[model samples]
Target chain A: MIRLKVALAMAAGIAAISSAPAFAAKAKSEEKADAAPIAIPAPPPGKGQIVFFRPGGMGFALGCSVNENGEKISSLGAGRYFILVTEPGTHQYSVKSEAKDTLGLLVESDETQFAKCKIKMGIVAGRPDIQPATEEEFRKQKSLKLVDEDDMGPAPGALRPAEIAAALAQAPAAE
Target chain B: MLAIFVATILSAAAVEAAAPESDGVSSADATEMVLSASLPEGGKAPLSDDPESARRDITIPKLTPISIQILKPLGSKLSKTGETFPIRLAAPILVNGVEAVPAGTEGMGEVIHAKKSGGMGAAGELVVTARYLDVDGRQLPLRSLHWAQSGQSRVDTVNTLNVASAASPLPIGLVGFFIGGGQINVAEGALADAKTAADFSIALPQVSSQQAGTGQELSEGDLAVPSGAVPDEAVDTESAAADVHQGGKE
Candidate 1:
């Protein structure tokens, strides 16, 4: 009887040990589901838009601040995105730290574009690089959130949280 | 044909305006004047008058596949992000039985990301993109050339060796943790494929413009309209604030 009891106890302990990781994974997925997804709206007529996002990775503490001609546009944190509305023309976007990387894009009217910022190993620190991204790539990142207003630059292009909400409201409801 | 020709001229004009030393208006005006002089009203554009101005438009449709050959060797440990390399067309772009862009035309490629192998069995990574082709002093943008590669990861092998060592009579505890991954490398003359980003109408000289149709004169309407649109100012702050509060609740 003692031998049978010991076997059952060992089996129970094994099951608990295996199930703990599954339970933790389930809890993490549940927590992810709890965060509401932010909505993106179309650019107002005659204007172009760019969605700048930085996915969470090795350099989570680094700030990916986007700039235009040396003027700050927004601080793109890890796992965060911001919308910048601008005139339809060729615009140059840049990010810098120990080094600077620039991406030139031809923003078109009534078109939505995406730029991805990645942190790579630099000589002294992590360097942020911006590259053109597609909409499919943008949708693949599920943990994106709107940037806080305090992180925005003094520039007049980036949409604030309030502006994004209003734009979403004004956008005709998706069929 | 006329619409595409006008658009190409305007595109060239835009490139001129974007130059650092350009005042934006004079160069564009000069381009317009040159275009107007070459194309008289109600007359077919002089297709073969001067070798320089004898170029005719040939529309390279969007998404046309292009093969390019890298001119130099590149490696994750040896390359840096944003570095540019010389590249050449590996094959001629045939449009309607004629070579539009020849095989020897040179272009530029950019390194998007390069990370050398690190300690703890981390692998090296490299990514590159085909930026553009200089087709007769005009920049023909290319896209979809995103190529990524990773070095052979030593993690699995190191783990197995470490486990075997730890199980030995004289155990070496986790010695594999000091090992590093391989460095990724791409040899010179490597072939890559990319596609035209958009519908680009390139000017081919009349000698090779047998299939090209007659070009049209540049018109005032053909000029690119200056982008004057500003951001929308109207915002429903109250509703947005409420929505933000609701999001917080979530």
Candidate 2:
């Protein structure tokens, strides 16, 4: 009982430390002292809307850019956003998480069997290193006899290390 | 390709931000920046081309030389077997080069009692949870909790500057793994000292004899110990050399 009380007390103290006015003051002062020159994300162009899928946990949305057709894409907008560049054609998208990483997508017009993927984790098929799966890659995996993602929660007691990869995705781009 | 490129950032430490010859920003801005500024993707992700990403990556080059060590428990409290040696330790954690984790912040490594070894074969069994700092001095939560940004204005920015601007970091937590017959080769209590090997030791936490109130086992539903901690044996320096050497092999 005492240990529990102590643990609880410590937790409360940490909570107080996180919110106390004095601590806040110190953190604020420290923030000023520690401030470094940073590059704020360039503002969004009037044309495209950047999107965000909630990071981790029950919330999962990358919050990519919205295309003219109201399709979600990741582009132009800055701020730790993913994706290199998408095709010019209109694209519809959703997310397929393999392990943990997430991404955005661009599709080739009218070619739907499996065109491209934009996610954080997926199998590369013949490729060994794990990558994110885009819609296209999903199709490719389907085509190549790879297992489909369960889309369900992990089994009870599974070791969740944090979690994934992929396409319309060669890598990070520089402007 | 880019994924591999980023993962390739296995090495390379960002020089720390120098402490202010001046102090100005308030914690609000600091919290806002820390919370809002976009964190480059990936907890272990690489530093991006963005200066902000680079600035965030600024760390005292760690994750190297800090090899994880697994030590076997002493055969019996009264007597023992094995060699003990000194292993270099990464600096005790610092948030912006400041030491914050007070003494006893670390309760020794987890203790495994009775039942035969659970570690590598033959090696007696015990689990070692080496505390480390990978998450920019800040300890990210283990359990997921809602960090509502709705009320908080978010500002995600990274600042890259010459070596002078990077700040030191804090020691994060440790991960536990089962290893038997091995002895940790670190300095005692992870005391801060001149980077000398003498400042090392491995001590595991002691489990109370009365049994943990929660009725939980050591591993998930395995064995149970009391709620409070057990007192560790008087560290034996007499066996230090042999312990270090044997601990290295076993």
Runs of candidate 1 exceeding 4 Å displacement: A1-79, A84-141, A162-175, B1-57, B61-67, B80-83, B90-99, B102-104, B112-127, B131-144, B147-250
> Any runs in candidate 2 off by more than 4 Å, and if so which?
A1-175, B1-90, B102-106, B112-123, B130-250
Classified by CAPRI criteria, candidate 1 counts as incorrect
lDDT (tens digit, per residue) of candidate 2 on A6-96: 9999999998877798877988887765443211121122112122221221112332222323333332111222222223222333333
Looking at model 2, residue A58 earns an lDDT score of 12
How big is the positional error of residue A76 in model 1, measured in Å on the Cα after superposition? 4.9
- Model 2 residue A25 CA deviation (Å) reads 70
lDDT, candidate 1, at A51: 89
Q: Taking the tens digit of each residue's C-alpha lDDT, what string does model 2 give over B169-197?
A: 42111101122222223224332222111
State every prediction's TM-score relative to the real structure.
Answer: 0.43, 0.15
| Docking verdict class for candidate 2 | incorrect
State candidate 1's DockQ.
0.04
lDDT tens per residue, model 1, A43-117: 887787988998776568998999999999999998999999999766778899988877766565566777788
DockQ of each: 0.04, 0.01
When just chain B is superposed on the true chain B, each candidate scores a TM-score of 0.60, 0.18
